[model samples]
Target chain A: DAGVTQSPTHLIKTRGQHVTLRCSPISGHKSVSWYQQVLGQGPQFIFQYYEKEERGRGNFPDRFSARQFPNYSSELNVNALLLGDSALYLCASSLAPGQGAYNYGYTFGSGTRLTVV
Target chain B: DQQVKQNSPSLSVQEGRISILNCDYTNSMFDYFLWYKKYPAEGPTFLISISSIKDKNEDGRFTVFLNKSAKHLSLHIVPSQPGDSAVYFCAEGGATNKLIFGTGTLLAVQP
Candidate 1:
């Protein structure tokens, strides 16, 4: 079985540009979540979608938004990107939403390394 | 403010020795704690986890101890092997279902 997969393993964008990162969840999984990991720091949750609905959101600003597809895939979009937006964007998938899925631990993709200059 | 913290940036241990990594969290609402291991260019993998209701949880060579009073948790690997070397992160989960993580600690097991 394939694990969660992310696209464009690497990307580069200029300040004020927009960026989109994509992710495909594992088979049979209905939850997709996005996270940001800066160099030398742990990942911070951005958004989580369950069954194509926004289930949870982190402290990220309006520039960050995400949507889940009918097939359970997801896309993370950052508008007017800033230099500070450079980081590894990770996508994770789980069986469902809520504590049960969280307790099961999320399966993560290799992540998209986004560099904004 | 960092809700989760791993004060030690790195740890080195001899093969076959025990390795311990510590984590501290400030949020009392955190109900579940987890550990993750990552290699370069890869996402973090799920490791062992423990609930706030339990003081200790073990799986094979790994054991996690949680001290609720101190809001501290520790991961112990016995008879560590070189393959165990990697960056380990501690994460806390609350009602939001989102995880807050600590700055990872790089562990190096020398042969």
Candidate 2:
């Protein structure tokens, strides 16, 4: 079976431009989460969606937004991107919101490497 | 303020030796912890996890120990192999299922 997948493995964009990253969760999984990993640092949570609803959010700025489609795929949109916005965007999926052991050891996708020049 | 912290930036160990990675957190509400391993250009993969009720959780070749009193935890890998070289992350979260991660520890396993 196919694991989680992300699109546009890498992209280069100018500052102030908008970017949308995509993700497809595992076939049977109902929850999808987004994370941002800066160079040399661990990933920070962004947003989570289950059954097309927003379940959780992180400490990121208001410029970041996300949505989950009925098919369990997700899209993370970053508006007015800054040079600091460059990082790896990861997508993960799990059975459900209250089901995962710690809500942490998720199955992650390879990630979209976003570069804001 | 950083809730989870992995002080060590990197560690080196010889093949077949024991490797210990440490993590500490300041959040008492965090009842669950997990370890994830990542390679270059790849996202982190789940390694192991432990709940607050238990002080230890073990999997083949990998084990995680938690000390709730001190808010510290460690991951032990016995007989470390070259393939084990990767960056390890410690995560803490609870009902929100929103994980807070540490800076990560890079393990370099030598032949």
Candidate 3:
């Protein structure tokens, strides 16, 4: 089976500009979550959507937002990006939420590397 | 404070030896712990996980041991292979389903 897929493997954006990162979950997966990984650091959760409903959010600012489509794909939008926003954005897909949300662990995409100049 | 921490920035081990990566968390509320492996320029891939209720969980050459009393966990890879060289991250799943990750430890398995 195909794993989660993300688009624009690499991107360059100027500070203050906005960017949109996209993700397509594996077949039959209904939950999509986003994480931001800065250099020399671990990934930090951003948002999670299950069945098009917001399930969880992280400590990110309002500048970071995400939404899920009916097809279970997801988009992460970052507004007024700052230099600190430069990082790899990862997307993970799962079957659903609850006890078994990560029974097999999350299937992650290769991730989109965003560089803010 | 970092909820999850991997104090060792890097570790080197000989092939066929056992590789152990340690993680510690400050949050006792975390109910699930997981280990992920990542190659350069790639997202994390889940390796093994153990629930708070269990002390140990093993799969193939991978095993995860959790110590709730110390809020610590470790991932063990037996007979480590050079292909296992990568960064390993420890994560904790909270009640809200949020996964907090550790900074990561770069493991280098020598042939």
Of the candidates shown, which would achieve the greatest lDDT relative to the real structure?
Answer: 1
DockQ of each: 0.75, 0.69, 0.75
lDDT of 1 by residue, B1-111 (tens): 549999999999999999999999898877789899999999999889998889999999999999999989999999999999999999998678788899999999999
Candidate 2 structure quality by residue, lDDT tens digits, A1-117: 999999989999999999999999989899999999999888999999999999999999999999999898999999999999999999989989646746346889999999998
Q: Is candidate 1 or 3 superior in lDDT? A: 1
- What is model 3's native contact fraction? 0.73
Better of 1 and 2 by DockQ: 1
Residue-wise C-alpha lDDT for candidate 3, range B1-111, written one tens digit per residue: 548999999999999999999999998776788899999988898888888889999999999999888888999999899999999999888577768899999999999
> Model 2, B2-23: lDDT tens per residue?
4899999999999999999999
Reference-based lDDT, residue A13, model 1: 96
Q: What TM-score describes the B chain of model 1?
A: 0.97
Q: Which DockQ value does candidate 1 get? A: 0.75
Worst 10 residues of 2 chain A by lDDT: A97-106
Candidate 2 — which residues are off by over 4 angstroms? none
Candidate 2's displacement at residue B100, Å, is 0.8
Clashing pairs in 1: none
Q: Tens digits of per-residue lDDT for model 1 on A1-117?
A: 999999999999999999999999999999999999999999999999999999999899999999999999999999999999999999988888653643568888999999999
**Sort by DockQ, best first: what order?**
3, 1, 2
Full candidate order by TM-score, most accurate first: 2, 1, 3
In candidate 1, stretches whose alpha carbon ends up further than 4 angstroms from where it belongs are: A99-103
